[model samples]
Target: MTVHLQQEQQTMLWTLAMHAHDAASTRPILGDRYAADLLDRVDDPPRLGLSLAGNTPLICARAKLIDDAARAFLARHDEAVVLHLGCGLDSRLLRLDPGPGIRWFDVDQDPVIELRRELYGEREGATSVAASVTDPGWWAQVPDDVPRLVLAEGLLMYLDPEGVHTAVTHALTPGSTLVADTVAPWVTWIAGLQPAMRAADTGFLSSTNDLAAAAGAVNLEDELSLVDATATRTGGLTSTAIRLFALASGGRDAMVLRTYRRP
Candidate 1:
């Protein structure tokens, strides 16, 4: 039951990210089933069941990486707000115990939001908004006075360069910090090699050779880190597929984590 949306590719990645989280939670890597159930709510049960048998390890690894970052942010800030831009069915709010002080917003398309509502009962301190991240209106609901930690996992590659810029710029507040994961441009070419990947979505690979430049475009002071899932043996289907893709595409494109903050 694939639900096609304006950004279909991005949606698929979001689902994939959720699946990864589910794998991690159920298997005790992250030590909870909350995130897994959140993912289960939206996933095509039969299709995911088949994939899990073979890809659980990969999925768990990717989930752990994302969970680690989310956990770290919650740990450091008592009043932090987590804005999961393009958040599909991820239940990070359920997975991390935020001590009743943190707020979590899950933003995505209307249909996705509806699906989440139907599948998972809403919890306290967690809200879902149906809006594009590029739209400025969504910010009205977020408290501007407090610190915000924005997570854009597997999101930017499907947005045009300008759209990504606008989303980052509009989402940024004086105390905002952004945690994003993206691939290098060459990785995009490699991603196209897999037939399954090519069928997923619409958007340009707006990644740059210099992640700092991309972040700077949105007025964020960027600190970039490399993420080689292969080196860490934590590569998921997408990560492994991207690695094979890099070989096929004939380049050295790498995965990266770019953290943006205001200086």
Candidate 2:
């Protein structure tokens, strides 16, 4: 399936990110099926042909944090809804096994969703919607009665600061919880060091050094956490790789695990 260069880049990054998760899940502590599924798709011709390099392990570690957050939500809410914004071609619905009662919405632009529909679109308890995350109308499709667990992995960095604020503000419900990952400003500044990564065509957008502040701008409570990829090695890159990148770039932190809740 041919797509625009930017769209193809996004798909490649997502695929690599999933592979990293699969690599990390080999560790007893982070045995995640979602990671495994991501690894399976890496060889698929349509999603292949991208250079992952050191970013692979970091992607996996980020994915584990998302899995952990999802598990937390599942444990607390019986009839929960998962909104995976900018879902790309990920198969988390199948890997997470949110059960029959749970409702899952995997959303992205129409083109990406169309591809997703062609691939893993037939699962029960899962539905795909074609819409940009910035659109307010997409929220109407989500039922208000059930608690929502929004997973925005690798999506925010592409949006302007205000865009991120808007997406979070509109999506928040009383019991809603958000799990996302973003790069620190320093990391964004030095992203060019990895020449192979530039192919992603990420719109060259990023945010402040602190993600908590970004979340706070939208009235969402924030908690900043670090993913210990070194502890669990499933493996594209490791915490050491992240640290090395930070060191090479004169950065204090590279990636962050951000959780948000409405007060």
Candidate 3:
């Protein structure tokens, strides 16, 4: 079946394509073996050129980092709720395979959730919620009593400042943590210049240079630079260039994975 998506939603396919490419490569970073199969279900999936293909390491590395964090969080709390916001078509629930105690919710737009239902059907411990992450009403579906692990991978950059605040605020309940990947202010500007991004009419709408402000009253636990992770995951000339970029940019322009916590 053919899957239709809007410009921003199309990005999910691109990310999935990247995962599929990484899995096929000799030195796989994320090693998402299921990505290839998922990509196959999409009719006429996005074609990745060298420009898009180059993002494989960075994208896959981001996934790896989130996976590690989620796994660790699940191990710590036997009863927890995972809110994978803007989940798209990612098979992270399948990848992590958390124990029975964990309740995982994959949330996205209604259309995206409909597509996801068609693809994966019903899962044991995972539920797909069809609603915008910015909508406060969706929070009712989530259990606030359990330790919440809110994942906003590649999702926060698309929201405006107020929307980001809303997402962060709702996620910072007692004993909850929010892990999100956000682009820097400069990266948002740079994304506007990309021909591909421009052609798709979809670019980053928001960014944060200050992690503390982004975290608000919550404690900023950790920050991981995607550029640094890419350099480590991809050794060679690419690694050298990334290292130099990190030094020159001081990681201010790199995509950062940030963890925020509320005691």
lDDT of 2: 0.65
Among residues 3 or more apart in sequence or in different chains, the pairs in candidate 1 whose N, CA or C atoms overlap within 3 Å are 9-201
lDDT of 2 by residue, 137-220 (tens): 888879878888899888887777777777877666676778877777766766655444455544435754434555664454
- Cα lDDT of model 3 by residue, 178-203, tens digit: 99999888788888876667778898
Root-mean-square deviation of every model: 4.7, 4.1, 1.3
Residues forming the 10-long window of minimal summed lDDT in candidate 2: 45-54
TM-scores of the models, in the given order? 0.75, 0.78, 0.96
Name the runs in model 3 displaced over 4 angstroms.
Answer: 209-214
Candidate 2 is scored at a TM of: 0.78
Task: Arrange candidates, best TM-score first.
Answer: 3, 2, 1
Candidates in order have lDDT scores of: 0.63, 0.65, 0.87
Give lDDT: candidate 1, residue 218.
49
Candidate 2: segments with Cα more than 4 A from true spot: 1-9, 12-51, 208-214, 217-227, 230-252
Clashes of each: 1, 6, 0
